[model samples]
Target: MNQDALSRELALRIGLAARALPDTDAKRLLAVLADCTGMPMTESQLANIDLATLKAAGQGEFAKVADDVLQQALDILKNTASEKILPAVQPYEEGEMPNSVRIACASDDAIHVNGHFGGCTWFMVYQVNSEEARLIDIRATDIPAGLVVDDKNIYRAEQIQDCKVVYVASVGGPAAAKIVKLGIHPMRLEAVASLADIISQLQQVMAGSPPPWLAKAMGIEVSERFKFDREAVG
Candidate 1:
């Protein structure tokens, strides 16, 4: 079958699997699936959907959207398996050191060395070992940052310029517009707290077993932070 046809089949199979769960789980699963697929689920859509229909529709693979759904599903299954999952893995402490794995505090003004950089003014560079991000460097220039500028140019500069990722807190519209043109992924975080929580959650999710929602999938695997990515597993 063609790619589209295959995607539809996958969606259909996933829908069917979702249908077999308890009503609450099924509803939650459907919602998560819908979000991952980027398709709005109306009441009728929710009521009438079946594995066969979803497969027949040819919606295909849920790439970008699947990460959130898979994570939620795993969390639900983990909670069902053990009520202490969150607390047992909680990284926070009472008035002690920050619980985040790699946090760039507000005062530091230095971005974390991930492959994704947000905004326009600042950007990042890195080397990849087997497509895995490693040895990233954060840099800044005179250009204003954020989403307003030509993102493609920044991406090209980064690509040819030999950088893997960029991180920034603030970006403008024109700057953001410019950077996207270069095809670089931007990682935007509002505050230290938000970034810390996400990092902690990801760590908890990765070390556990595959959640019920993803156990049957072919290539699905959880990362150290509990986030799901196609290329995360070796």
Candidate 2:
């Protein structure tokens, strides 16, 4: 959502819930609303909006309150813009192992894992869980093509250090070791597939029969939850 629109929506929500929110919270959200909207509003106006109205707001009406609240709260404390929501890890679906996971792909086109780690120029970071997978950012590499820098893998690894896994067309042994040392798994693929296809595959894995490496990555213990095909039993 756009900054102005986001600010307005937060303003309305805090306003509607003013009766239920703490006085300090009410004041903070109200002030942010004014700053964001560039309109003056007194505490009385904020108090006038009651809990009933907030309860009536549809889910869409308050699509991003938790995220916006944290952002606006930080902005208020720091006296920053407090309008745009900061990008952060989103909550995942219930029963989804590890709750959430972040993955990075070496892709110039942003749709496939089609680049060598050392030479790739773009990396797409995404948040993945069972219910949904969302693209968070398309980060650019600091190094340009054909530079042959000594720290090419270092640079690429640093770009996605926070990610759990990185998909690439190729990775050198030393480079792969560097990535592994940083606790990031590297997957080398001979042929790249569409990001959508990758996501579909991931969803299928989450649905059933996740392998040991995957179960470990997702923080799921290998236990009775592992289902077996009854007919296949000897």
Candidate 3:
């Protein structure tokens, strides 16, 4: 991205980290902004940033994302906030698409889908549109061990019901049944695989001629063709 886009990007990052992370971590997020800006910022400078002031002044690199967009985002977040405002993991790598789908990965780290369905705590949520695949949030599930099978299965399914697809290393019969009951598709992948690459493959599936199951998973009507370029299908 050009400097103009970079500035807007950093400002958005600040808005997200500022809204989601603690004050200290938000202060440290300045380092990320600094890294993008190619300049070093002192803690004193970062510590002094007030949301309203920064929202209004929008000085220097922060100017591009100024006014309504950033302001609205900043107003909605707090450290004690329970609701999640989806976070961006990566910038759009390809051209942005008009339609997108959300997926959940059963994993410990957000970078890999390698966790057992029953025992995993972290659910890496991602939004995948035609143009890009980006991380949105890392959701936590509190299905305690020693719960009965049905209860734990329902808890696991409930945690990711918002997602249309879920990737995991393994899924118990009961857990998979509950997930299917919720109308979310369960997929088994290798214990360790690149999350980005997996998202990319899904992107490709959407881009090319996807199978009936995949097309249905994406909620695309088969009659639509979904812009699939037959020639591009290898």
- Root-mean-square deviation (CA) per prediction: 19.0, 14.6, 12.3
- Write candidate 2's Cα lDDT for 1-234 as tens digits: 122332453454454444333344566555444443335543223323333333233422333445444444433322233132222334444445344567888864443567789887678776677766766777888777677767767878988998888888888999999999988989887776645556657767766776766667677776644545433563
What's the ranking of the predictions by TM-score, best on top?
A: 3, 2, 1
Q: How close is candidate 3 to the true structure, as a TM-score?
A: 0.53
Candidate 1 yields a Cα-based lDDT of: 0.34
* TM-score: model 2 vs. ground truth: 0.51
Error of 2 at 129 (Å): 1.4
lDDT score for residue 119 of model 1? 29
lDDT tens digits by residue: candidate 3, 96-157: 54456778988654335767888765788777866666666677777556655558768778
lDDT of 2 at 200: 58
Model 3 worst lDDT run, 10 consecutive residues: 77-86
- lDDT per residue, candidate 1, 33-84, as tens digits? 5753446432223334433433333253322334444434333332222221
TM-score of each: 0.26, 0.51, 0.53
How many times do residue backbones clash in model 1?
45
Report the Cα lDDT for residue 128, model 3. 84
Q: What's the best-to-worst order under lDDT?
A: 3, 2, 1
Report the C-alpha displacement of residue 215, candidate 1, in angstroms. Answer: 18
